[model samples]
Target chain A: MAIDFKQDILAPVAADFAAMDKFINEGISSKVALVMSVSKHVVEAGGKRMRPIMCLLAAQACGENDLTQTQRLAAVIEMLHTATLVHDDVVDESNLRRGRPTANATWNNQTAVLVGDFLIARSFDLLVDLNNMTLLKEFSTGTCEIAEGEVLQLQAQHQPDTTEETYLSIIHGKTSRLFQLATEGAAILVGKPEYRQALQQYAGHFGNAFQIIDDILDYTSDAETLGKNIGDDLMEGKPTLPLISALSKTSGTDHEIIRKSIATGGLTELDDVIRIVQNSGALDYCRLRAQQETQLAIDALAILPESIARQGLYNLAMLALDRIQ
Target chain B: MAIDFKQDILAPVAADFAAMDKFINEGISSKVALVMSVSKHVVEAGGKRMRPIMCLLAAQACGENDLTQTQRLAAVIEMLHTATLVHDDVVDESNLRRGRPTANATWNNQTAVLVGDFLIARSFDLLVDLNNMTLLKEFSTGTCEIAEGEVLQLQAQHQPDTTEETYLSIIHGKTSRLFQLATEGAAILVGKPEYRQALQQYAGHFGNAFQIIDDILDYTSDAETLGKNIGDDLMEGKPTLPLISALSKTSGTDHEIIRKSIATGGLTELDDVIRIVQNSGALDYCRLRAQQETQLAIDALAILPESIARQGLYNLAMLALDRIQ
Candidate 1:
């Protein structure tokens, strides 16, 4: 299914992403070649390119067929997304990302930080060139929301009793805001308000599901597949939804182990923690919640006319959930 | 003179700065009150509020009659400046800033970084509200330039033979860009096209003078007056202009002492290093060069009609140089 989605929907958008790479590389100054080199390294180290692809696909799906603006918007979203990741790696102090050393790890923290700032500045430059105030305002607001979400997450770190409402808000800020904006921005460019709203709803739900799956995979997937160490979220002391949900449900021995693991933020007794979570049915619980989100995302797309892009988006949502388990 | 500038130009701007503080504080969600509180603590710690005050004063001097816009621009620039400092403290691993514990020191690195991100986002939010495209573009470009400067400085750290050109470029990025933008942005806002170019020129010269003085003060000033420990830059292996110039002139025994001292980057024998710098005439050379730049800044203001604000700016430039020695 992943291969099919990649072939049918993401292939054309991949070309757009390539064009973006060209644009950014061209923008690099000779004096700051180190910044450009490090930025390119992190950017070219492959992610799914899901956000840009969604943007391109959503624009196409809306039946406004000018590929140039869509492609630029796609690149802009991806660049913004990459900038956030660079900053996130610093904030998380993560040594690796996507099976490679992070920019911060390879180059010092200062380089990583400044390059992140450069990328953000470059993104805004590209955004202004797009010449759409409404789109610019939306994207800028989305960027702020993402930052706020990150701050909220930082504040919530290591606190075991973080409520579900807080968790949802954080995820919305950190994950869903950008995802929704990507689609919504594309729709705005395409000049379809109704479709833009529908795409935003679709992307928001999909993003929530995507984050849930990401948290679940943190526990279930090994380092090789996930491109990061298993239980990294635990080690980082991020009180993700699954653990919090399980803590609320279980008590006594189960609750104590989960609580201590989160507080200490290590895998000292990995098997024991895994056993507690498995026994508590936390994984299943998370998967059920993700599935529900995926369904809602699919429902959001029902308002749009049936098309390959819509189907591709639906498949992507399902893939987000299925990839975890 | 410094005290008077602080009282007149800076004090009024301080009131506006207070309003800006209130604006940002109100924007933060109650959910992350702790993070906001910590962020506010770091921001409110007594620093001269130099950048924002420059923005306000420059705007007023450019014949911008509206105090409110000038104040808003001042607050925005300062917020951006504060954001950079917060991130910089983390990158530099410094424990103190403005005679208080740094955000990174008080909290962890993650909180410092995220809060920096939050502040930057808030700055953008403020910029968007200002609805000035040219100002936004210049400010965004300034951010990129500043980050580039930081990266340049980071690359130059601990490199014994760092060139004068590289040193100048580094300072231009690290300090001059903000000053250039603050003053130039003010001029731009006031619709003073003729003075705008000169204001930027003045800012450029003044910023160079300001940073050179800062470097000189790192050697000459006590901790109380400087709000940072003398030799802090040396301990951090920052190859500032005075040291570079001193290195260029000296050879044999004195050169070796300077080299070894810089290589070690601590004040085990700080007094001895200070003696070598003083004896080498490096301090005098830097002081002379800074004074020249201040003169150039004053000359740049020749086109502007004389007013209290212009006199204040000229006095501020001279005061910056005087404060160093």
Candidate 2:
């Protein structure tokens, strides 16, 4: 059966989701005009509010009904996501994301960078208001890893020697660590210390699955379907899973072509690279890896009680996988 | 009484400063090679470690000689300062700072941006370990103001008619807020709540004086003296105090020239603008304002007890004022 985002995945936490969504606006209401406008644009432009929903769902799955702190955590999660997106646009020099113009595109890099800093600081400010040192430490350390992951990606750019292990490290830091923070932080806030490891594992595997699916889409999906042009990673010389796997699968000229394509990023060798990546079974390997991660994520959820919220989280993971299928 | 930095300012808390400096290295120690290298280069390139010194001195002035927690706070202040400088170099597109290559110049903007992020997160992570929620809230809110001040500076850039009041607000955010954080945070960390107001006032006024002197030197000091080119602010069309004061002091062509210089950023009319500013009593006005701020900063220290550390902070304020004279 097809999963609906609102009815299936977000149903158990729908009220909490709506409340958390309002907090994002309150979190971003700044005295500075440019901050308010730019933050509004980027936060409003955010797609589906996925990460915050994950935070809310995870909170409920832990059987903590008090939605007050959980809602704030959800909002903080979104603010952190928005901050990274602002900086990512500046780093990528991107004009648009998911159909809307990015913060950097709308207000230049200087404004975007500073506002991103503001969002990060404000998120911490709100987190401090929660009066939980453990949660603050978790988020602060999580953010550092997220940033390191991004730099590691930059460090690996145009380098063909990057291993799958390095790629996993990159994806985990840039992508999964925040997911871990969202779920694990909720458990921390709820005082369910026992659930911390399980939630972190669930979010970790889920984030890996999500990112792998994204990497897969970079090679397989069309612009209309993905809201991003295919070969976008290639243009940036991002040695994502497909290119990395393709290089590993091929040999001689095919290997050299893949290596060259990863090293000198552009779409000049677009057709040949795509053909080689597809014909060489690189996509198949990626799909298999993604499926394994999804299974691990689903298994991690078993540690939580069988509740509607747990089912919602499971559905969310499955829905992310459905995008590829 | 010509002030010597080591004797007059750093002497009282020199040992704590040394210990705190170690924390900076420890804090920035990451497995990511690029993060470590870029962070080390920028931290090594730091100027005087003034902020951390203020934190240590403030802790000492509060009569809390327990250097354990204070040392960590001082290091956190410096890490935060270094983080801002890294991003500031990117924002200004500056290749050099303090006669050394900037992080953006040494690495790339992407690396600098991400590493700056890592520093911010690391600083917060360390702050969380201090386990003081009040201190955490102060810093979290303080950083938000800092970022806003930066954005306000960007928003006011290239636009003339920026009022002196607006310029003061800008300086307060960009310069004074962090200074306030450095000293005020020390008091909070040391459990001297009453001294928070006094230390905050001293640091705030001192920061204003410091920034005013720095801005004055932007027009008056040469690359040889200040390691920065004269008219650097004008090149960016920054409506700093000298420009703001010059506009108020002039009329007719002289006024129009200052306005045009600010409106259209460049050095075409740099000499004329500088001549008009110096000859129009703008420099004297700025110098007078700097002196007044320095006096105010010193007066704020009366609430604190007579201590060697307080004397050092007082001497540091005076030395900053001496830069203009």
Candidate 3:
């Protein structure tokens, strides 16, 4: 049976999710009109809000009652996520995100950059209000790693020599680190130290699996299917996992094409590159890796008490895998 | 009295300033080569390190004996200031800062933006290590206002209707708030609650005066003297204090010219705008405002006991006013 995201994953924290959404709107409130409008635009453009949902579920799985502070944490997680996306759009020079005009697109790079800075500052301000030293440290360190990951990705751009280890480091920083912060932060807030490691492990593997699947789709899916154009990564010469794996498996002309495509990012030989990636068993290896990661993510949740929220956490991991399947 | 910066302002805290400079280099260390290099570049491009100097002096004036953690706080203040400058360069598309190529110019906007982000996160990470909730709250809130102030300035760009009130609000966020954080944060960290208000008042008014002087220089000074071009603000159509005051004090073509120049940023009417700004008594009004702010800054230091550090703060304010005199 196919899993339904709304029924199996978000259902456990539906009310809290609603409350968290409200808090996000409140959290981004600013006296500056442009800041408010840009923040509102990007926040409204948000999809699924999976990170905050994971935070809420982690709080519930820890068996916490009365989640007033938990809702705020959820909101902060989402705001941080939104802030990154806004900056990412400016970096990518993207005009459309989730079928809507991005903040950079609507205003300009200056507005996007400054508003993104405001969101980041506001997120920390709200986190400080939570008054947890450990949580603050975790988030502060996590954000640094996230930024390093982004710069590493930029460094790897057009360098086909980037290895899988480097790729893992990049994905871990850019994607999984925040996921760890989300669930692990909830554990810290709820005063459940024992559950922190498990949730972190769950979210870490889940984030890796999710990003790998995203990269794989860049080779396989189209703009209509994923809301992200196929070959987007290739066009940027980003040596993602599939391309890296394809380099390892292929030889001679096949390898040269992939290498050259990465060194000089564009879609000139996109069809040939995609065909090579598919034929060289690179996509198969990526699928296997994604499955393993998803399994590890689900297995990590075993330490948490059995509850609907825990089930929801398990289902969210599986749902991510379902996208590639 | 020439108010030599080296002799009067920096002498009292010169040793601690050295320690803080070392701390700044160590603080920017990163596992990622690109992040480290970009951060190092911008930090090296920094000017006289005024903000951190103010922080160190504030610590000494508060009667703090041990300067260990105070040095780290000073480093954090400088890092935060550098981070803002990095982002500002990107926002303004500036090629040089203090005659050194900017991060965006040396690398790219993507690198500059991401590295700027890394610096911000690193600053917060270091701040979290200090384990002071009140200080963290102050910085977290202050950074938000700083970003909002930047966005407000961007909104006022090409907008001639901007008032003196709005211009003050802009400068407060863009320039003075960090100054407040530098001094006020030192007071918070030193456990000198009594001095926090006085230090904040001094830094806030000093910041206002310092920025007003810088704006005045934009009309009067050139690259050879200030490392900033004349009419740079007018070139960007920024309705800064001089331009705002000129508009308030002029009429007919003189007023119309200033209004049109602000409405559309460029250097076509540069000479006319400067003449009106000078002849309309705008520079004198700006000079008077800067002096008043400087006086307020010095007056705020009266609450602190008579110490060399207090005198150093007084001299720093006086030195700023000397630029206009």
Candidate 4:
């Protein structure tokens, strides 16, 4: 499904996406070459490029196929997303990302941080160039929500009694906000308010499912496919949905072991923790919940006219659920 | 002169400025209380509150007396400036600020960074509330420039070959951009375009003088008065204007010691390094240059009508220069 969607939908826009990459690379000036280099390094390192592609595809779906604004906005969203990742690596203290050393690990924390600031600044500069006040305001608000989400996550970390509502709020702030903004910004730029709202709802639910699956994958996927070591979230003491839900369901020794591991934030005996989660049916439960969200995300698109882009988005949501299992 | 100015002008607005503080404190929401608390702790630690005051005075100096927008813009500038300080503390890894434990040292780098981000986000949110796109664009651009400047400074650190032009650019980026923005934003809000340009010039030149004196003070001032250790810049290997000028002028053994000390970034033999800078006449040269810039700043205010606020601005610029000495 993923292969077919990528070949048919993402292929035509691949060159435009490449052009957006080139635009960002050229955007960082020579005066801050070091920061630009570090920023470019992290950006150029392969990711799914899912957010930018969604942005461009959303624009295409809206029928305002002006590739200029579409491409620029695509680059802007991607850069903003990448900036958050660079800072996240520092906050998480994770050494590896996307199968390679994180920028913070490669360069010291200081450089990583300043470079993150540079990318964020660059994102704003690009947005300002678009001269759309509404778009600027929305993007700026999105950035703020993203920051608040990160702070929420920081507050949530290592706390065993975190509630599901709080967990959802954190995911909404951290993941869904940007996804919603990416599609919504595209729709706004193309003057499709109804479609923009629909796309926003689509992206928001899709993002929630995507992040849940990501957290679940941390438990079920091994080091190779997951890029970094498995149980990293546990090591970081991130009480993700699966673990939180699993903890709520379990009792006695199972609960105590999970609580102790979260408190210590060390996974020397990873197999034991994984066994508890799997045996408790938390992984299956998480997959089921993710599937539900994916369905809702697809449902949000019911108002929009059916197009290849809309289908691709639906496939993307399904792919997120499928990848987790 | 400083005593009289502070007693008369600053003391009166001290009440109005105190109101601005309430606005800032109220701006942080309960949802992100932890992050906001950390931000407020640093902001309220009793730095002079000079920047916001400058914003208020600049607006008043233009002969417009609606204090509402001026007060809000002042708070916005102060929040933006405070955010940079929080991030700067993380970048510098400094432990003490304003006679208290630095936020980064007390809370941890993650909190410092995210809290700083929160403040920045809040600054924009406030700007959006003002519904002035001109101020928002100007302020946002100023922020991006400030980040770029800091990135340049990070790269320039430990490099002895940094030019005077580069040094000026860095200081302008780090200090003057926001200084200019504070005054200019106020003027724009108050509907005084001519005064806005003049105030921007005044603030820009004043900021340069202020920063130059600050660097000089880092070399010559005592720890008790400065609230920071002398040679803190040297320890950080920051090639401030004084050090850069001294490096260019000195030759033979003195030049080698200065270069090596900057390269290594320490004050193990403090007296010796001070002696090199003193013998090179770098400290005196920097003071003379700062005085010249302060005069230039005062001169830039010539277009404004003769008013107490204008006099207050003049007094503040003089106070900045005198405080360094």
Worst-scoring 10-residue span by lDDT in model 2 chain A: A14-23
Best by lDDT: 3
Give the better candidate number (1 or 4) by TM-score. 4
Interface DockQ of each model: 0.57, 0.88, 0.93, 0.60
Query: Which of 1 and 2 is the better model by TM-score?
Result: 2
Please tell me which model should have the higher lDDT, number 1 or number 3: 3
Q: Which regions of candidate 1 are displaced past 4 Å? A: A1-3, A12-14, A27-30, B1-3, B6-31
Which digits, one per residue and each the tens of the lDDT, describe model 1 over residues B1-325?
Answer: 2447666556534555566555545444335675577668766873777887788778778876676776667777777788889888988898988778988899888778777777777777777777778887887777778888888888888777888789889989989899998899988877787788889889999999999999999988899988888998888777887788778778897788778777767777678778878888899889898999999999998898887677768877877877865
- CAPRI tier for the interface of model 2: high
Q: Which ten residues in a row have the lowest lDDT in candidate 2 chain B?
A: B13-22
- The interface root mean square deviation of candidate 1 comes to 1.9
Model 1 residue A158 distance off true place after TM-score fit, in angstroms: 2.2
lDDT of 4 by residue, B55-92 (tens): 88888888877777788888888888888898889999
Model 3: how far is A129 from its true place, Å? 0.6
- Fnat, model 2, is 0.81
| TM-score per model (chain B) | 0.93, 0.99, 0.99, 0.96
Tell me the native contact fraction for each prediction.
Answer: 0.60, 0.81, 0.90, 0.51
lDDT of each: 0.80, 0.92, 0.94, 0.82
lDDT of 1 by residue, A26-81 (tens): 44443676887887888787487888878877887787656687777777787788
